[model samples]
Target: MFSELQTEIEARYDIHFDDLSLLEEALTQANYINEHPNYHGRDYQRLEFLGDAIMQQSSAVYLFKRYPDWDEGRLTELRILMVQTRSFAALSRELHLDHYVQLGHGEEISGARNRDSLLEDLWEAFIGALYLDQGQDAVMNLLEQVFFSKIDTGFYDRFVDYKSKLQELLQKNGTVDINYQKISEEQIENNEQIFTVAVQLNGKQLAVGEGKSTKDAEKVAARRAYKDLTMDK
Candidate 1:
């Protein structure tokens, strides 16, 4: 039934599915199921949940090993950015996966197929299908093409949270309690509040950063500290 999509997907990813139903479920949206009523076709929500976890694990392991110097917080943030709804949607669009989504009449009228949330779910569900039909390695193969390859080529480097990067650097050998203390918050000429925060390592102030909020300030401080550490290395 999904022969055309299967052929296209196989040609694109260089892998054939043992069970075409996996691909079918991945493409079938909930609305489509509602429209079918008595039809036994499964929706993608359950698959999406599973896919979410799989992607998280794959990216976590990849980031952990690839960026040996990055800290937990930084890795968390980077993974967040990578797995964000829009990110998944963009990846789906790039694969032309959106074209294969099975939507209900109302959904097609409402244009749900092109939406970020729906596309994101479809993408995750597709990953879930790949994992179920093959295994983690198969899903990882797809990730390498979309996610890891982008990282290697410096596509996502700009989004790195430097503060987390610094924290990760400090804890490379063992546990380290890092502190970000708020120094001051004052109104500037435009009446906008600005904050200064100091990042301390082992009771010693390593660097300070200024921003519009404590979180931003801490991130700035961490970026500075990371810069210093890398320069010294």
Candidate 2:
């Protein structure tokens, strides 16, 4: 159904796709097959499954060699962060994978094209297809090219603390000065005042929250602001 993209994808990656059928399967969404009962084309689900396992192993090996001093617990956390949905989605977007994905009419109308889960699954399926088409070495090289680029730039560190993440994201546009402004303090039944805070970006209110203290309120506000500014898009 999406044969048009075969040429563009190959040219973009400089790949001579031997198994074009597998590549097509990797780009096919389940919805596309479900919508066409007689269609013989396979969905990306199986490829996504294999890709996930390969991604986990590759990330673990990379982390093990890259951080020799870190213990198991820290290494595991770092690996998780590196292969998380957000990370996958970021890489997919960077690769412009969305342009090549095939979607059913319903999914396209519902705005599923830019969904993080969908992007992540498509990325994994692409990895699985690449692994099948070339080998583990090719998949590893592609992953390192994308994932390692982020690692070298300390991308995961920004998300280690969501508050720091929100701040960094807001600060990307130098003109928009962001701040967490305390709105009010109201005494509760226990005589403890609940602080309400608003995250403002360039005088515009991004999000608001209430907590037992100013610090707590700021964190809550930051979390909400992060979700609002990021998830909606």
Candidate 3:
């Protein structure tokens, strides 16, 4: 029944399912189940739940190992940015997985297949199915090929602003005095000026960084402090 999808999967990721029924279950939706009363197979909800957990573990481990310098907070934020619903939905569309979802007649007409929420669920369900059928290595291989590769400096810049992130983390408990101060400026090679900035908490310097501009230096300092504080925690 999923021969076409199987072929596509094999061609795209070199993965072949041991049991195609798992794939079918992953693609199936509750609406389809409701429409077909005789259908005894499961829908994607349970698989979605399981897939979410698998994604968390897989992504967390990947981030933890790949970025040994990253503090827990940064790793957590990056993991969330990578596995969040919007990201999963975007990935599903990128892989053309949305086209294979088995929606009911009404859902098909209503465009549920295009909905981000549905696509998110479908992606998780598919991951769940793939893990169950082919084991963790297979799923990890798929993720390493398609998912983790998508995370780059561009992705980090788009989702993470270090100054803002640091401020949010520090202020999580209560009001905190956080400030950035430019300590020194010097003209370097090519007549470019370098600025040194320090981030302070509670009237004490936490970390310092240098950049081309005061703002940039402050951002760097904030990032350093954030990483240091999060690591301490």
Question: Residue-wise lDDT of candidate 2 within 79-158, one digit each (tens)?
Answer: 88888887888777877778777789999999888999999998898888888888988887777677866876767654
- TM-score on alpha carbons, each prediction: 0.67, 0.66, 0.68
Cα lDDT for residue 136, candidate 3: 97
How should the candidates be ordered by lDDT, best one leading?
3, 1, 2
Q: Give the clashing residue pairs of candidate 2, or none.
A: none
Number of backbone collisions per candidate: 1, 0, 0
lDDT of 1 by residue, 34-128 (tens): 88879797988999999999988898999999889988887897788787787888888987779988899999999897899999998899899
Please rank every candidate by TM-score, starting with the best: 3, 1, 2
Best by lDDT: 3
TM-score preference between candidates 1 and 3, better one: 3
Residue 147, candidate 1: Cα error in Å is 1.6
lDDT of 3 by residue, 85-185 (tens): 77888878876778888889999999998999999998999999999888999999999888898786344343446898888988999989998888999
* RMSD (CA, angstroms), candidate 3: 7.5
Where in model 2 is the C-alpha error above 4 Å? 1-13, 162-233
Off by over 4 Å in 1: 157-233
Higher-TM-score candidate among 2 and 3?
3
